[model samples]
Target: MSEASNPVVEGSLRERAARRLPSHTFSDLLVPVSSALDLAEGHAAGHAQRVTYIATSLGIALGLDAPTQLACNYAGLMHDIGVVPAGAGLGAYTRGDERMVFASLPLLSPEEAAVGASDSPEIVIERIVDHVIHGARTAREFGLPAETIKGISAHHEHWDGTGYPHGLKGEDIPILGRIICLADHIESMIDQAGPLLGRRNLPLWLNQLSGIEADPNLVSVLRDLASGDQFWLGLFSADLPGEISLGCSRLREPKGMRLLGFSESLSQLVDSRFSFTVGVSARVARYSEALGRAVSLPDLRLKQLRIAALLHDLGQVSVSERIMAKPGILSVEELEVLRNHPAYSRDVVAGIYGLEEVADWVAAHHERMDGRGYPDGRAGNEIPFEARILAVADAYVAMTSDRPHRPRADDADAQQRLRGAAGSQLDGDLVEIFLRQVVS
Candidate 1:
């Protein structure tokens, strides 16, 4: 579907997000999202956080202004945002496999090479480059600073002009991109090696690829920063997110609506992971808002509900595409893994400030009034009222939307299914309100 006609891209939700973005810090808003992105790529927690720390520190040490430093910080957090959509074309390669392929680009392990043996090198490079291209587009759509978008676009470009998508050489790469490139590599090293060993070897590693892989000037700045034991200690600290936020205190905060757009953009990215599920979150949010208004929920409560609806499936990123796209019933183990996503969603959202209540509602989206949910078995009013509304909206959208395993139910059939499940699999009143008011 054309983006302009897509319900998710409609302006009403963007207005709502705009209205809510001003009160929170940009870091507070994006750190949870960074964690979610990490989950999508199958990386351990804190990769983005560490990258943000390293890139921002390098920006500051290099005498960048506050705005540039903030861009560096955000670009670091969201550099790989394209990976979700890019994974769609990478056949049979798990997110972990994709990561390995990208990390060892222009070189592949025997197994990695075997997976794509039939594909030409140009095709593989194009697929790998797709992530950065989509990432830059997403960053722009979210109304990020121009420099931030450019940095994301060029983060993978090598100084020697061998990168994919575009191979601009030397100073052709944005400085912020150069800093992030170095930071991204350094963070990977730290993740592969323990912090102590990573720190010890960083100087040698930087010297070996100083001009080929990254900007030599940025490498020198990082080398100087690495000399201080305190830098490594701070980066590996348990409260790395907090430290990054504190360090960024002097930078300008993003306006409220931009942060909201960022959240909406992320929800779209999550939905893009599977073709059948495209726009599911947006539809759910639309229905949930309609239901919330019908119930006369307070404005603040409605806003919270909207945000939760957009992000309710944030944990779905943890599920493998193979399982999600399975044309038949999932095995019991696979089903269990699928069922655990809400808990993963909760853990990721709870890390964001002021979203604790939203996190709880998101976690309970699958709970039935009859206590049949997998993650939690709260029945009757035990489930949060907001979550009950979310459940009805989710059920309606899922039924009406096509899935790999089933055709889309017609409106009449979907309504009947909602009515049938009312009071058992779903809250009866919310279902009635949804069908009678919202659906009508």
Candidate 2:
């Protein structure tokens, strides 16, 4: 994973991000991509959403206008987008969760926490200081506004001048950055606290960071916002992402090709998290779209099919690499966890606006046509045709590509096995169509 940081765009990240309007809103693309980042840690599920809510609400409380508030909201959602892959990789080799180390390293002095004291100092420094830089770049790539990109780049800056990748102190830090810093830390505290207790101790949690960690002015705003029951209610609500989606205009634009590019970017990032799964999504996407065309699917349906193919395996990030790379057969328990990835993938995609249908197809990709699949037993027509196409594409890619347990399959052998499973394990007609396309 590259720990390189993007130089802050001179004018605005938001302007750069808005240069192109994709088929869907930026968040529609970003929320699912954020899922991959959120899943990088074992304990941080939904952390991005919660932080975004807190930051945006704080932005509102601070009397920022709706556009600036929306920018803050985008900043919150993607603040840590760059940290996950490298953080996950670092943690895998370190003694414990390196996320905590990365978060706290900025605050600690040289003797207290030597940055390079651990294994692989170069990579460690890159992970620590460059996340915000890379995050800004990602937002730029995703076409977010300049303010949003700057906020993402500066979210980790400390009030006391100790933060990394340019530690501007006090009021010098961008206001959006300051808001997100508070939101990001507060969310971490709430996560660290058990759910029931976290809500109860919100005041204490806010107080802990007032002076050194967060800007005191923003902390005051957060305190005011925290006083309202509606604030907490909204934060914990099942529809928080929906509520957030309604407020942000930048995330609502409909640009089909940009949305497709958004999915491709996310798939590449997700694929990078695993050593073996690189390029799997792209191949599946190509095959799935070709199969869709061969079957004479409409253009809109073809786009949805492609998006689903790109994101089909995002949930696997949550599964342990150990289990995924195991050379032998998995135990029943391990297998169960692995099989639940599609459900996870569905939840991730569904959280984004306008991708709910695509989420359904992603969830159904693992289902068997004969009612024998693991996650859901939907049989035959019960599975969406798009999903059936996805299943065949994913399965073929898996078989033909190298696996930890077996060498890549020859085309004839792969086709024979796929043919054997057609009616029962896959959709027979789709399989036939797909095979014909491949042969041609």
Cα lDDT computed for each candidate against the true fold: 0.81, 0.76
| Model 2 agreement with the true structure over 1-440: per-residue lDDT tens digits | 22234344533664554443335666665655565567654546677888888987887777787667767877877887776455535544444445555545333532333243456556566666666787788778777889999898888788898786797899889989888888878877777776678778978877878878799888888788878788888888887766767767544434453777778887887777556688999999999999998998877788888989999998887776567766799999889989999998998888766678989999999999889995888989999889999999999989988877889999988898899999999999888887878644
Residue range 275-333, candidate 1, lDDT tens digits = 78889999999999999999999777888898899989989887776677878999999
What TM-score, over all chains together, does every model reach? 0.88, 0.82
Q: Name the best candidate (by lDDT).
A: 1
> What's model 1's lDDT at 227?
94
Worst 10 residues of 2 by lDDT: 105-114
Candidate 2 local distance difference test against the native:
0.76
Error of 1 at 257 (Å): 3.3
Error of 1 at 241 (Å): 1.3
For model 1, the stretches where C-alpha displacement exceeds 4 angstroms are: 1-22, 92-122, 258-260
**Going through the candidates in order, what is the number of backbone clashes in each?**
3, 15
